[model samples]
Target: MIKESTASAFLFHVDGDGVCRTALVWHPRLEEWLPAGGHIEADEGAAEAAVREVREETGFDAELLPGPSLALPAGFPHTAPVAPWWVVEMDACADNHTREPHRHIDHVFVARVHERGADEGAVHEVRWFTEQEASEAEGLAEDSRLQLKALFAMISDGSLTVAA
Candidate 1:
């Protein structure tokens, strides 16, 4: 099992089409390319934390798609996972603070955004970049890139469902 303090990720895809676009947050810590998510906090579920984190960090209010939280099983590296993950996303960032202060049992959720925004909450900025662009971004992990690739495939194949 992954440690509780590990940071989880949640990439929100907005208006995904030919390019398979997504919203990338410039995290101050890693100083690298990453999604709008972090550790899960106390007094909340992982799904709720993901939605709240995306909104607080990206100025986009996301809706966490319902289902079992996507937990990486023991010893299964990111590349070998065959099934798609729990996807969630939004383009409207709700007003909130972005200081993520918690340790957690990491659970990454993949989501597609419903709308595009030029500006929003505490998030310094927002942009629609293709999944390919994200995959090639500096400092991103191969596993993360593969995960995004899988997410795009699911989005393209109509296996992903978005709930308002």
Candidate 2:
């Protein structure tokens, strides 16, 4: 049996004029707007990775509005039940064999910036998308849209607390 794993995180920021915006990285597979995130490095924590990823993808440094915590949307199916022992291992192994899900269990944070600033020279390209723009993106995940809407609402208000 081989054991391997990956962790990721994303950031939500508000651009100038209080327009809640998020940094969406262009994923090669699921080519669409997605929250800024990536795999957690060997020596980095979830939040740290998310902050670094946001900066690397968007060239804007962000502060984690909240710590490493689970931000499941309402009625998230995670708590349903654990699969059987072998099934869990099989699923993990099959998933590993195929491809590592990039957005799996990403540690999410909230941060507000007056602007997106700039884009890092990395291969990753970013866009400041409003909720409507994000929702309109083809193949946009429902969960991601929900999360972005929550962030937009919080940023729209005067506070960017981790209420999402």
Candidate 3:
């Protein structure tokens, strides 16, 4: 199956109630709630695509949390982009008569929203889900639920900071 590159952002923010929440959208095709993301365009890298998708889908400007950086020697010839928290390849479509089967190589990143904005370009209804709510949300993929749980655990343990 052909594989398409994609970038996904797990955008988190503190709500007025002082609870950390992540944005999710109801995907009609997949019939599940998922992170805001889409295919990486030909002109952009995964990190860039992640940020762009978040803004387009949620109308929020988000900054991706920096991943662990390598200690390169001074003045290295290469520039490193922000790394993703995780990467996985999953089936995008299967056993469909109209569409061919394909897999998506998804680069996942954790980000913090700078401020709230209008949900103008959102293609689907958006909702903010608390960690607990995400974990127990119906119609959520199992992998997504696991990711949410891990994100929440990291935040609680101070391992992953969502502050701007």
- In what order do the candidates fall by TM-score, top score first? 3, 1, 2
Lowest lDDT 10-residue stretch of candidate 1: 88-97
As for candidate 1, its clashing pairs are: 4-104, 13-113, 59-93, 60-92, 60-93, 61-92, 61-93, 87-110, 88-110, 88-111
Better of 1 and 3 by lDDT: 3
Candidate 3 residue runs with Cα over 4 Å from true position: 94-98
Steric clashes per prediction: 10, 0, 0
Enumerate residue pairs that collide in model 2.
none
RMSD of 3: 2.4
Q: In angstroms, give how far residue 33 of model 1 lies from its true place.
A: 1.2
Q: Which stretches of candidate 2 lie over 4 Å from their true place?
A: 1-10, 67-103, 157-164
Which stretches of model 1 miss by more than 4 angstroms? 5-9, 13-19, 67-104, 161-164
| Candidate closer to the true structure by TM-score (higher is better), 1 or 2 | 1
Better of 1 and 2 by lDDT: 1
What TM-score goes with each of the models? 0.64, 0.63, 0.90
* Model 2 Cα lDDT, one tens digit per residue, 1-164: 44433323345554446455566777655566666665557886655666677677667676556533345789887652111101111123234234653223344555544445567564577666766888687756566677777656655674555223
lDDT tens digits by residue: candidate 1, 105-149: 355766556666654665634555576676677766455667678
- Compared with the true structure, model 3 gives a TM-score of 0.90
Preferred candidate (lDDT higher): 2 or 3 = 3
